[model samples]
Every structure is written in structure tokens, then in C-alpha cells.
Target: MRRFERIHDIVEPVEGYRRGGYHPVHLHDIYNQRYEIIGKLSHGQFSTVWLAYDRLLQQHVALKTLKADASKNNKELSTLRHLSATNPDHPGKRHVLELLDYFEHDGPNGTHLCLVLPVMVSDGEGMTVNGKSHEATYVRSISKQILLGLDFLHTLSIVHCDLQPANIMVSTEAAAHSETFLQPPEFNPARWLKGMTADESAPNYLIATQRRRGQLDSADWSELSVKIGDLGGGGREGNHRKSVAPTALRVPELIHQNKTWNASIDAWALGCLICELATNEPLFPLGIFGLSAEQIDHEHLSLIGGLLDGDGQINETFVKHLTDRLPPDFGAENIQHLASFLGLMLQQDPLKRMSTVELLKHPFLVGDIEG
Candidate 1:
């Protein structure tokens, strides 16, 4: 009933409230008379995620609603449905985010597709201790879990074209309770825009508040787990996507565009992520200080070349470079083994990158490197 003069800072872009953009959703709004919207989780370029309570299942779930235009040809929805139907018993499946449900909502804008997923504590980067880099053992655990997740998808001939820290998420456990679930904050329904009669294209009110569900800092690392999420850019193996990963995380094969890239791109990203986790810095920190997008790509490719030799193998000097970048607390032997392990995944040639199965068996992941 109350109206606001202007859009709030915390909510999504107001321009997105158009015919083909984000669906206007208010708190307590029920989709298909089932999932009750609780609060805002997050938003992206094409979709907004909301925390919702499923009446049928009586559990909290993340409801991702894609824009009207994005819903027309949604590959992520198709990929999720495919994953849900296949390999229900695989061990690696547990490491991947599960698609609980999906359906369409015809709003004022257009028909939007909503996906229901388990509520995670936070993104994969949350594994860091109190906003700092994680210990070597913790990083190893997170890396191993992510590898298992990739193994699950790759085994099914699926390629997560955009594997990064943000796509990897920490899973929630029943024992690790938090106020996010117990105390769902109630907000005053957003008012219609000032001086405007009920706009059919926009929601009557926008939920201006955002809330994160869980706390990872206090969680027991021994019991906590991570899952790979955000399959929007994913596709079947050998689909030949045109460089989907972030510039700094892009692999040489993707940058060169010489061959058909595949799931191995995820492996390459895992290698970069390992370095970031070990040192709290991106291995390829490009696009800084007024660098253009083209310049960033060029710099990234150059950095990759510097890490390899004429034979396309990781050069000895690069190994030392990795050692120097890694934390000294990792110990000399552990750093050496980690450097060797990363070398297997960070190959300039996609064919040379290690498969998740092989990576899972590596000495670093198999507990050879002491914590």
C-alpha cells in the first residue's frame, strides 16, 4: 500500500522492470501457489534469486527466476533437468548442486522460468577463514570436492563452461544452524513508483532488503562441504562454446581459439582457483589500471605463455614462480607437490590437462601432501 519516490539502492536495476526483463516479485508472493518468497538472495544479469519456502516439501530453497527473454531459450534449465534425471546414485552427484524443481510464471512482463535449488551457505570463496586465504589442508579439501563435482558432470558428457570461485558454493548442513532460516525478516511491501498509477510492467512493490542465510567462518571445516553451481553457461561436451570463462580465468585453448574447447576448461579454472586459494590473489591479475578488455585478454595470454616452455610444458621457472606466490606456511614439500599437481591441470594444451578422475587420485588430493 505504501509507495516510494525512487528505487532503492539494494534492489536490482529499475530499468530491468521492462517487458522482457526481470519479473517483479514481492516478498510473500507465491509462485504456482506453492513456493512462498521469503527474502532476496541475489541477482544476476539475467535472473534474480530469492529465498523461498516450499509448501509441498516444507523446506527452504533458492528460487531462481530468469528474465522473460532469458526464459525463451534457457539452456541452464534444460541442463538442470538433464542432470536431475540422470545418475541419481553417483557419489560425485552429491558434490554437485541438485535441481529440486522448475516451472513457469506468467507475470506482467512475460512468462519467467523459476528453478528451485538447495540453499547453500555461500559461494566457494566462503571457504576462506574470516575473509582471508584458507589453510593448505582446507584448500585441498575444497579442491577435491570441486574435482568430484566436475567428475560428475564430465562423466555425463557435460561441460561447465563457466567454472569459477563464484560458481562453486558451500553446502548447508542441518546441524550447522543459522538465523537465516529461522528468522525470515518481514519487509514493508514496496510501493508503486511515485506519481505512477499501478504499472502492469512492474511489481507493486520491490523488496529492497538482501540477506545471506548462513555463516561459514564458524563452521567446522572437517564437516563442511562445497558444491559446483551455476550451470547457465554449461553444455554437453564438445559443444564449442566461444570463451565463456572470465578473462583472467580463461585457459590458453580458449584464449587462442585454435581448437574446440570442452570440459577441460573447468580443469584449467580449477588450477587457477587453487593458486588463488593458496595465496588469496588471482594467478592472472589482468585488466588492472586502465587496461581495456582487449588488453586484458592479451595480457592473460602473455602470462600463460610466460608460464610454459617452447614444448608447451610448465617451465621450471614457473614452478618457482608458483612457489613464491604460495604462502610460506605451506611448507617447502607441500608447496612442491601442489605446484606439481597444478602443473597437470594448468597445461597450455587442453589435451594435456588432467581429467577429474586422474586429479582425484593425485598425491596432493590423495593426502600425500601433509597439512
Candidate 2:
């Protein structure tokens, strides 16, 4: 066990330093004597991601380290390996994040699984410009790329249960240049750990700042591309999952605990993403300040129900609602086609949802509509 003089203001929770929790990673720490840690990228409930430079390849990559406990039953590594090996000729393959390398590292906490991935600059949230949605053309282009990525995953019978905006990553040309990508903040380990007495279990120093990247709005949309990432919640098509997707983006099947939910859940999420891209607001706002789980679920169901009739078709009310939310410059034809396109994917019945193939062929995505 390790103890500090006082808890430092680190980005991740301090309590996560306990046994079977986060590995105490420090700046300049070398893993497998090949990858050197530069800084932290992000952290989640199950893992912490770091920015590392590969010595052999002489390139920067994102190193995701899963917690000791979570690594025991994790299937993400296997799933990613399978994805990397199969279907090299598919056009949609380029839109999916590839797993470059993976290994197990034994740290003070326990054995943890480490994953090597390409460094991404931004996510779907970056697509907005100062809290406003992007141009209609840019939105459509991003939507098409995400759809193609989903197509590739669905073709492999892999279901990315979580497809929210944060998981949709965008890559920039600037990231490929070593001089620009290797920028690290000024950090002094001796200064930060000066008054603390720590064991091997504690990180030499904690990074309080996260790496920031240029916004997608500032990039040239024609050259930039997006990839579907974070497949930790993913599973085979026919598998049963107790939980899937964020509450706001959950489909009827996931909300109702349908054990047989399939790739159609991704289609439903894509519909939500399309609406969010067109308008800065989410279709279902369940992140209220003081709402219970049951209350939020009820509100979400109501919002979804309001958009579909008993036949699972788009209702007149929903058409008006979406039209009102869209940009004022959108023409009546563009709005009509957009609503129709959303109707095919956002259905109550999973079986009735449009497949990736059908969605890719729609006029909304095929450049027929000028949205």
C-alpha cells in the first residue's frame, strides 16, 4: 500500500490507486522498453489512456491500459485483433479504428492489458463551432463516414453497443507530423512529489492537465476523416447484454432489456447522431440535474414515442418538431428527405430498422439531397 502527504489534484480519482485499480503510470515511464509515456489523454471507469511514443516505430500512439480487474474478463483485445485481420478490401474498413499492438503489463496493482492505437485529434463534439452545429454538407459527410464504419463492424457481426458522440473520433493531418504531435507540457516530477512519501504502487507524478487538440471546425472537412472508436462495450450480434449505450441514446430494445438486441442498436444510435450533427441539441435530453433513473427512462421513452406512430412510421408531429430544430436555410425538400431517412433507422422494432446497406443507399447519404 502507498500513501501520499496530501492528495494531489490529479485528473483521475485518487481512490483509483488502490489494489486492482489504475496502474501508477508516470511521465517518461517505459512500457515493455518500447513505448515511452508522454502524457495522459483520458480516463474512464475501467481504464486510463496515455499518449506514448513507440521507440521501434518512432511514432506516437494512444496507449490504453485497462484496470487489473477489468483486464481479466476483457474481450476488447481479441475483438480488435479479429477486426484488424479480416476484410482488408472493404471500403468501410478505413473508417474503423485499427488496433496496432497489444500486450500485458504487470504493475504494482496487478496485471493490466495495454492496447496500442493511432492517435486521434478530436471527437464528434469537436465538429461543432462554438456550440453551434456544422454546415449541412459537413454534417452529411461525417454521417456518411460513421455509417460506413458501422457497416464494416456490422458486416463482421460485431455490435458497437456504445456509439455516442464521444466515441466517434476524428483524425487530422497535423497528427502525422512528429514535431507537431510530440508537444508535451512542462512537468517536474521532483517538484510535484517533493513532500510525498510514496511506494512503488503510487505514480511518481500525476498529470493534472489533459492533452488538447484543434477543433474539427477549424480543419478542412474535405481532407479530415472520422473513425468509430471505443469498442469496450461491443459484443457479437446475438449476445445478451445487461446494459448498452448511453441513456440518452438508448433504443427501445436496450431500454426494455431485450436480450437479443443486435446491430440494429447501432443504427438507432446513428440516427440520434445525425440529428445531433444537424442540430446542436440532442434528440432526447435525459441528463437533467435532478432526475432519477426511472424518471429519466420514462422521459426518454416518451420522447421516442412522440416521434413514431403505432405503425412505427414517422409521425407528422415529429416531422414538424425536427423541421423546427433544423437550420432555417434548409429547404422543404431537404427536410422531408432527412425526416424520411431518419424514420428508416429510428424505429421501435429492431427488426424494422434499416440495415447499414439500406442506410448507405438512401438519397440522404448518396449526395442526391443537398443538405
Candidate 3:
């Protein structure tokens, strides 16, 4: 009895958290040893991503600094670990974002967990791989790489809940570290230029002209590689939102109160974003505060929904799952522009919607001249 009690004491504490919480990892909180938190780039509900420098490896990386919300962080860590494990054998998991190191930091409120991500290109916002701003080509490059990343995640039965230009990064040999820099170089505003210089434009280019290359260069898009991110909303879904896109670049099932959403939802969002990127505009420009193109954040959704709905009289039971109310009167005409393309992706019925794999084969992407 005493021996069992002794054994129980030793095992209980270990099992309590190592099993109940955390990523089954025991790592250091040292900055220089592992990574140097450079600056805060973006913040999410549970984590703040950092522009970090890896001292050991000596490279620039984006670090997801998680605020220990307890519930949220625990969930993210476990899922990432699970994906990393199950993903090893999955064909889709190959060469995505390789988990380099895990660590924690002391915070005023509590301890914060962090994940280090490799920095691709600084061409986010309007920036481009060439340091100058361009369009079309950059959009195609971003879309194709994102597709590759999604394809891998889909193979593992994972749906990246959140994917956007802000989440995707550009990877290129030209973008690689120069050994001394050992990180994605910090862009100098004054140094930003347009088009390659004379000699460099051909073969033996001048070093000075390299930075000014066009932002929309086909190379930017061609060099795109993807890394699926922010699984906070990531998961498998049942059919529901087929009739609508979710509030945030969502599919119909997601918006129509879907019970089961899957890779298709992710595909739907990806397509919409690609459409917006292609035009250098928001597919659903209505800001979170501002809804559809007609204004009013949640007006009729008619304009948005019209792109997908047809016949005006499909079975209500079939669509009731997608939405509870009739969408706003988008007039007799439907949104045939980008929304129409997105409409096909948001096919309320999962069977009808395009799968991530299928989307990769679409003419919208596959037939890209620039890509």
C-alpha cells in the first residue's frame, strides 16, 4: 500500500500537466541561445507573432508568441504537435513549416509559449519580392504556393481555419540569408526601387540593381511556397455553410450555421482571397464593421449569397442547413464577377463544392499565364 502511494505520488504530478497540458516539450526560455525576439509583427486572439532572429541557426523567423490563455494555448500546442507527428507520414505534410524549436518566456501576467516560424519575403501588404510594388503576378505566386500548402494539410485531414495573404510568406533563393545576415533582410524604404538595373537585367547583373526588381515580377509568384497557419479555427467540418461563405472569407456552410465543415471551407476561403488578390482588392471588401459591398456588415447577404444560390427554389431542407433566412435581394442579377468564382467554391453541399485538390486543378489557377 505504501509502495503504491509512493508510486502514485511520483506519477501523478508528471501525468497531470505533461499529459493534461503543454506540448510534451521541455525547452528553454533563453532568447539568444535559441531565438531573439526581434519585434511584434501581428497578434491573434491567443498569440502574438514576433519577427525573431535565431541565434543558434542565425536566421530571421516569425515567432508566434502565445499568451497563456490556458485554454487557447493548450489547444494550439497540442494540435501543432499532433499535426507534426501524424503529418510525418502524410504526403501533404512534407516540407511545410518545419518546427524548429519551442520555448517559453516570462511575462508580467504569466508565462507565454512561442513557436518559431521561418521568414519568407517581406513582400506583404503592397511590398513585393523585388522591393517594388506590382500586381497580378504577385497574386498568382501567392495563390499557387498557398494551394500547395493547403493540399498537404488536406491530406492529414486538417483544415487550416485561417489563411490569408497576411499568413502566407514568399520563399526564394534570392531571399535566403547571406550567412552573415542569417535572416530575412530588413527592407530599407529609401533603398526600395522598381525594375532590375541594366546589366543585372540580363546575366551578369550589377549587385546594386538586384533590389529594385519589379514587385509583380512573374518570379515572385513562381517562387511562392506555402505554410499553413493559425489552426486555432482549423478542424474538420460537416456540411452546413454550402449556401454561404463564412463571415470571415467563409464558405456558405460555415455562414449558414454548418454542423460539419471540412477542407472545402478552407478551399472556399482560399479561392475568394485569390480572386481579391488577382484584382488587388478584397473579394469581400466589407470590413468586419462594414459588411458586403452594399455596406451594412450583415445586410441581406443576398449579394454575397446570390453568387452561389440558383433556381430560387432548391429544397429548403437542403439549404436550411446553409442559412436560416433568405439572403438580401441582390436584385435579379447575381454577382458574376469574383463572387461568382467564389460561389462555385462555396457550393453549400460539400459534394458540390471544390476540394482543395480539385481547386489546384482549376483554370483560374492552373491556367495562369504569369504563374
Candidate 4:
């Protein structure tokens, strides 16, 4: 059997955008349909998400336009298609956001994969999730949703290497007119065109307008489904020679030493994702990319000392890869106690890391799941 490679190992982004003019699938003369492209919904390391609308659906959807990386694209599409087929009744993979449609197109940049998904619009920033009875309420819901997804994937023995908020979507459930997205008179095309550029005023300005797409309701979803997007770093069982885990969400043992982990690896990521939602900040709290290992340094057995059975050099495999491996003071200076609760989850040892199975059923999340 081959050994698993330490993941997040790409020293640089792949260069592949030179070839252009990729075209997407258009059903029912979609090119002629009236749709609008809103500003960015979310942007990640390799893709940008756009909030768009369809004149026919009269609803908002998310359009993810990925950069040109053919090798990664083909791999991602395979997983996405599998997930899509499973939840013929659910989008967003039956967890958070609903997956709508998949389209491949050629553009000025290069070949692109456009994913249409449901939109979770917010009156405020950071998933203004509507219900905020308490901080733990948010923490609990977010955690359980993520854990449920992790648990589901574990059954298939697949790990979502990249698990973060920019990759997450809250549920858009029970929306009132005021809560929903509709183009008001103030935002209508007729009035929105008044301030167009002088060049846009040309007779066929619309003919030159950027191609506008529409909202895609693939199968219609109601519950808050949590779906893991971005398979760029994913791999099946065996053939572990390739790298797949994202550094930030990585378990100390897994990322640092090339240790093979099962679904439990995602439990660590689930804890981190919930921490971000609870505090509205990243759990690991990264600096620039180069300084990442230092940011998540898992040294000295300090973080998970009590949890490990053989406390010798816990996370030793993971800590050695970093530029620096000094043990954190773990006091007021090194780590803050924003949610003293999170300390229970971010354990240094993968086995000691908070288990999503136990976590989701915990009192913190159990009540909220009911709520």
C-alpha cells in the first residue's frame, strides 16, 4: 500500500487560464433570457461566487466560476456529480445550501466550471442566519449541520479536505417577502440603466453587455442542508500518494506527519468551522499563507496533553514541518479565551480532537438542533 502524502503541498497555483472561449449549457434559449449578475457572494483561493437571478424563476441563485485548472476540474466534477445524483431530492448535498445545476463553459479566461446553487442572502454580514437567540444557538446549529455532513461522508469514507465558511452556505428557509431577494423598482433594469457609462449608451449597448445568467433551482430544497464544496484536494481510499487536505482544517497528526485518518479527521474540521461561526472569525486565525504552519503549530503536547493516551511528542509528525516549532505559552498572550468552550474541541491529537458524533449530540448543539 502507498503512504498518504502531506496535503496542502502545492507550492504555487497552477497556471492554466491561457486557453479561452469555454461555453456553458443553455437550455430553452437561456442566452436570450433576461438575467442579472450581482456582486460577489463569496470568493475563495481558486474561485469566485456570484449572486445571480433568472427572469423566469424570479429568484436568486449562486454562480461559482472556477479558475482554469483542468486536472482539478475533472476530479471535482466527478465528486459533485456523485453527490448530485445521491440527493435527487436534495441540493447542497442535503446539508446546507441546495446544489442547482452544473455547466461547463469557455470564456476569455479559459475553460470554466459554473456551479449554480441556492442563495442564502443576509440582511447583515456573515450568514446573518436570522435566528440568534444566543451565541451557542448559532454555534450549535452550525456545528451539527457540519457534523452531520461529516458523518455522512465518513460512511462513504470520503473526507472534505477544504471545510470553511467561504465554502459553506446557510439555509434559506421560510422567507417572507421582506426577507427574500427581489429586484425592487430601485434595482430594476430600466432604472438601473440610467447611470450607465457613456460607452454603454451606444444603441446596442446590451449587445455588448456581459453575459447575464439566471437563478437555477435544480430540484428545490427547503431544509438547511450542509454540502461540502471544492473537491480539488479530495481523493478516494488508497492511492494516498497524492496530497488532498487543506492546511487550515487539517488535523495536527494528519497534515504534519502524513498520517492516514478516517472520517474522524473531519471532526477536527467540524470543530474549527463551528468556532468560526460562533466568533465570526477563523478558528486557526491564519496570517499570510507562508506563515500558516506557525499559525496552526501543534507542538509540545500542550494543546491536547490530557487527551492523548501516549502523551509522548503528541503531534510530533505535524509540528516538525513548520518553520518554527516553539511551544505556545497558551496564556492570555498566545491564545485568547473568547469562547472558553472552543478549547474542548481544538485538541492537538486527531484521536483527541472533538468527535462530531459526540459533539452534535452534546447539550450545546442538541437543544439548538431541536430549536
Candidate 5:
């Protein structure tokens, strides 16, 4: 373990526990003998992310500093290690995040675990790939890549419990050129004005310009390359009996309080994600007045119930229970195509839901775009 002077000795605690009383790192602070902090990226519930310049490899990277609570840190570290091992050639596996390195840094609170990851572009929210609106073609391409990555993990019996938009990231280059990606001179953000131009008319492109962080002139939604990230909420399949997905993205089985689950829950969340990508809206809007877990489940059930049969229960033949719940103007063929797929994923019963591999071949994914 690496130790440094107590950060609290020199600085006051930040308002959030995620920072864990660590002294603020400046634009050029170096750590682990290689990385130089360039900018603060984001702060999460238990960690903070910074964009850094890697001295050893001569590239840009994202440094995730997490409060060294042994259990959580260990879980994420082990999961990342496993992923890295499974896919040593990261650039080829464009759908998965590559962990370049991890080390411990001492602070007043405790040892903080810092993970060095690829610096990915920021989509609209933390969950999306591009800030601009994607056509159905782009959505389909992105969804296929995500499914391939999920297949890789599920094959190893690993379950990414929190597979939402925030955890997915987009990269400009293919994995082959990752080492020198975003290196100095070549990575000048100011050059964006001279290189590529975005459609000013599009709302998503307008938002991207406003954010101005992680924006790339060469990034095109139609050619978007995405990766799955944030393994903190992930684990080996069947390890956690209770549901772990966030409230809005929670599966019916989780909301129903199912005791046993596998990687299938990720399929449910993927269904929600694909819908959001196509429509640019969350399928189920979250209730503002914080509802209890049960209350949330009740509301979720109501929305899904409209798509089900007599008793609104999931069963082996649940596909037969599907109804015409899609919007009236969505077109009859698309409604049927989507209902057939979402029905398999949103099944109230885990056993009834389609496997991720099977889901990849469904019409909603394989058929021609409707819109």
C-alpha cells in the first residue's frame, strides 16, 4: 500500500463523502509515478474521477479515486482485473473498458484506490455515448456492441448489476491506437474548430457544444464506439440474491424482490437503455417524491401491467401475454417488432426473460430500422 501525509492535515474535508477528505489535486499533480491530473471529471457516491495525462504511456486517461473501503474497492479491483485478463488486447474489444493500472494512495481517511482507465467522451448525461441525437441506425449499432460485451461477461458468469447509460462510454479511436490516443499536440481540443463541424441545428449537438468537455471533432454518432464501465455494482452471477439495479432501471424480478438471479437482469436494463436511445427518453420516468422500494415496484408494475395478460403475471408462455402498449403512432409493424422483444426482456419472471445471447438475434435488433 502507498502512504502519503494525511490530506486532512493540510485541507478541510470536501462537502461530499465521495471525496473522503482528500486534498484537492491541481492541474499538474502527478501520482503513481506517471499520471498528471488535468481536470476534475466527476464525483460519485464513493469516488471521484479526474482526467489525467499519462507520462509513461504518453496518453490521456481517466483516474478514478475511490474511498478505500476494503470490500467495495476490492470488488471493483478484482472485477477490473478479471476483465483485463479476459481481454488483454483492449482495442479489439471496443465494447469494454480497459483498466490500464491500479494503485493505492494514502489520505487522512484511509488508503484510496485509484483506477487508471481510458478517458472517454461525455455523452449528454454520464450514461449516453454522444451528446447529439442518434438515428435508429446508430442506436442499433451501439446496442449490438453493448450486447457483445455483455455476452463476454455473462459467459464468465459475471453480472454487471448496474448497466445503465452512465456506466457506458464512447471512444473516438479503435482499440488498436489506444496507447497514443489523445497524446499531446494530437489531442489539442482547440483544433476541433479546424477539424470537424457538428450540425448546429440539432439539439443534442447544441448541448454537446455547451458542455465542451470530452468533445471531439471526429466523433460521429453513426460510427460511435462504446464500452461498458463502472464495475463497482458488478459481481459474479448468483452472488447477490437481491436486486441491485437502480430504481428507474430496476427489472420486474428485482422489483418483485426475487431471491435468485443471474446475468439476465442486465438484459432487462439493456431493454430500457435501447428504448431510451431510440426515443431519446426514458421509458419509465422516475417519480420525484422519493418512493419506498415497494412503492417504486408498485408503480413499475402498473406501467408494465398494461403490456401483459389476464393476471399480469409472468410465466413460461408470457410472450403470449404481450399487448399493444406501444404508442399509437409508432406504426403497427414497429409496435409488434418492439413488443416481441421487450416482452421477452421485461418478463416478470427471470426464467421467462430471454438470455442476452438470444436477445441479440431478436427482430428489434436484427430487422431494418423503422424510423
Candidate 6:
């Protein structure tokens, strides 16, 4: 019998794996006879997420599978464990995804690490019920929740390197009544490990992969809560990984490749995310330039570069007057307050950016503010 590898041995950002050439798990294929695959949720660079039903708990779950060979020392499992132990004190704060269970399974791709997570819905559910923009109140509420989640992570010195729209999911009341039918795989880890690693067993009718996509009803949007998902790019304060947020959401510090950055980088990302949520469009549509990576960096700097005065400290006057420079869409209602908040979050210098703890206390979080 082969022994399971130690958890600490796994590292973040495993390389060399791709979405193609991997083994396929059939419909109704159950692992340990505990989780039955209902549908494929999505695929990533090194793993595939499947929507499954928990036979023991009788609830829906998202199962993420990572090829064991490519998954050395999985950091996400450890991060979830640490977060669970830390336990944020806010009762209403359900902004982070909860890890229910995890185990190893052998497939045609060799051994795979499977993580059981709660299924998530879309975030834009109820905001546009009337077809007008999402009100400032709803935007404030969601932003507060995201800040609280960030505060929890920053308190523990963890940096969520990615915080894009895709990583933020919404949970709705309707999901409780949803149901699906699927068959379960027979329990036998040893047998599956010794099982064939070829793709010949795949059913002719089955597609190699399926994508799970969802949209929320406008009425349900108000009842929806946001949770930050996908911590695969996250790590302890100084892990030094390249390219944190998605291109459009990338902060100056990350774009500059400064290795000394800490949790404040997340502040920049949260700022960009909040702007998009408020405007229903990307804060910085860097793709419009369509330049190479180096040129794109310059374009980003040009937008926020003026925040830095000759002395290099944050120009209080510059950020204070940001409303004049920013477009009207950011504020829709309370322009001054929103512009000030974005200024604080989008500081050109990482050190000058507001910490999550400080950002949570800003006037913007409470209500509208004067410049």
C-alpha cells in the first residue's frame, strides 16, 4: 500500500499541469461512495471543479480535483484549516468560502486531491431589479462584507493574491431547495489507484468536461450574500509570487514587481473590485490598449501615477481631489465619498495604501462623506 504524502510538502502554484490530457470521472461516479458527481463546475490550470451531492450530509457540494502528481504540498487546504481555526468573530460575516471535507482519490490521472466546498451562486442577483444601477446602499453592504473578509485574512498575515469578480460568489436562499440525481462510485481507493490510467473507459456519450454557470434573479439579488472564493493564488505575507490579481485588477505594487508588499496589495484589488461592482464595468479596461505586457504596465501606471508627488509620500491633496479626475459613474450618488475611498485604496505606494482594518473604518463604509 502507498502512503499519503505529508500536507506540508505541498506548495502553492504547482506548475506543468494543463486542462487537457487528464483522466475523466463519469457522471454518477462516486468517490468513497460519499460524494457523487452531479455535474462539472469548472476547470483551472491545474484542477477541475465538479458539482457533487453529499450522500452522508444530503446536501450539494463543490468538489475540486487536482492531479496528485502536480499537487505537491497543497497550500489551500492548509490555508482553509488555518482560517477555520482563527475564526472571525463577526456573526453576520459569511464572506469566505467554507471547506467541509477533503480526501485523496485515484483516477486515470493518478492520485487526485479532492476538496469538498459549499456550492456558490452569482453575486449580481438582485441589484438591478428595476434596471437602474445597483443602489449605493447595496454596494456599500457588499463592500463591507468583502472588507471584513479581508480584515480576517490580513489579521492572520495572509494575502489573497487574487480578488476578481470570478473569485467573488453570491449565495442565494433559493439554492437550499435545488436538487439533482446522480449515481455514486463504488468505494475502493486502493482498487481505483491500481485501476487503469487510460482514457478508453470513458463513455462515448459523455463530454470530457462540463462548465457550471449560473445567474441570480433580480428579486433574489438583495437576499444574496457574497463570499470570496479561490485562494489558490494566496499565501503567507511574503510568498513572492508573480502576477497576483487579474490583469485588469492588478495593483501598482504587483505590476511594479515589488517583493516587499504585504496585505495592502489586497486593498488595491478590493478597490478595483468595488469600483466594478458600483459601475457594472471594469475600473481599468487595460485590454483596450491591447499592448504587450510591458506596455500594459505603463498604461496602468499612467492612470494612477499622479497620486505620487515629487517627494514620494502619498499626496493628500491629490487623493482628496480625486473626484475631479474620476468619472461620474464611480459615485453615481455620493461622488466625494466614493472618490475618496478609491483614492485611499488605489495609492501608488503600497506602504501608503489603507490597511484592511483601517479601510473598514473609513467614512465610506459608514455612509456618504464630504471631500
Task: Please list the C-alpha lDDT of all candidates, in the order they appear.
Answer: 0.76, 0.78, 0.48, 0.45, 0.62, 0.64
lDDT of 3 by residue, 1-371 (tens): 01111122111111112211222111223463677644434444454455566777767776675655454446556667776777466444633565666777544344557776665443333332233333434444566566777787777666677666555544565653422223232321111124522211111110111122233244545565545565555664442333233465755555555577566667767766665444444445555553454344344355455444543233333233222221233111222222333455655565677676766665545553421
Error of 4 at 267 (Å): 0.9
Question: 1-371 in candidate 6: lDDT tens per residue?
Answer: 22221223222121122232234555688987899977755556666777788999998888887756545588888888777777558532467887889888766446677888888644332232223455556667778888887787777788898888767767665663354221232221111223435233222222322322234534343676778877778988877677557787777767787666777778888888877766665657675455888888888777565443433444565444444444445453465566667778877667788888777777777866222
lDDT of 2 by residue, 200-283 (tens): 765655565354544455676677778998888899888877445878888887677666777888899999988887777788
lDDT of 4 by residue, 55-75 (tens): 677776667666656524466
Cα error, candidate 5, residue 223 (Å)? 2.5
Clashing pairs in 1: 190-205
lDDT score at residue 240, model 3, on the 0-100 scale:
32
TM-score of candidate 4 against the unseen true structure: 0.59
* Predicted candidate 5 versus true structure: per-residue lDDT over 113-186, tens digit per residue: 88998877654243333434444456567778888888877877888898777777766655323433323311
Best of the candidates, lDDT? 2
Query: What global local distance difference test value does model 5 have?
Result: 0.62
Model 4: weakest 10-residue lDDT segment is 200-209
Error of 1 at 97 (Å): 1.1
Ranking by TM-score: 2, 1, 6, 5, 3, 4
lDDT for model 3, please. 0.48
The list of candidate 4 runs beyond 4 A from truth reads 1-36, 56-58, 70-73, 87-93, 122-134, 174-228, 237-248, 286-347, 352-358, 367-371
In order of listing, the candidates' clash counts read 1, 0, 28, 16, 3, 8
Worst 10 residues of 2 by lDDT: 186-195
Off by over 4 Å in 1: 1-11, 125-130, 175-198, 204-214, 288-293, 308-328
Cα deviation at 49, candidate 2, in Å, is: 1.3
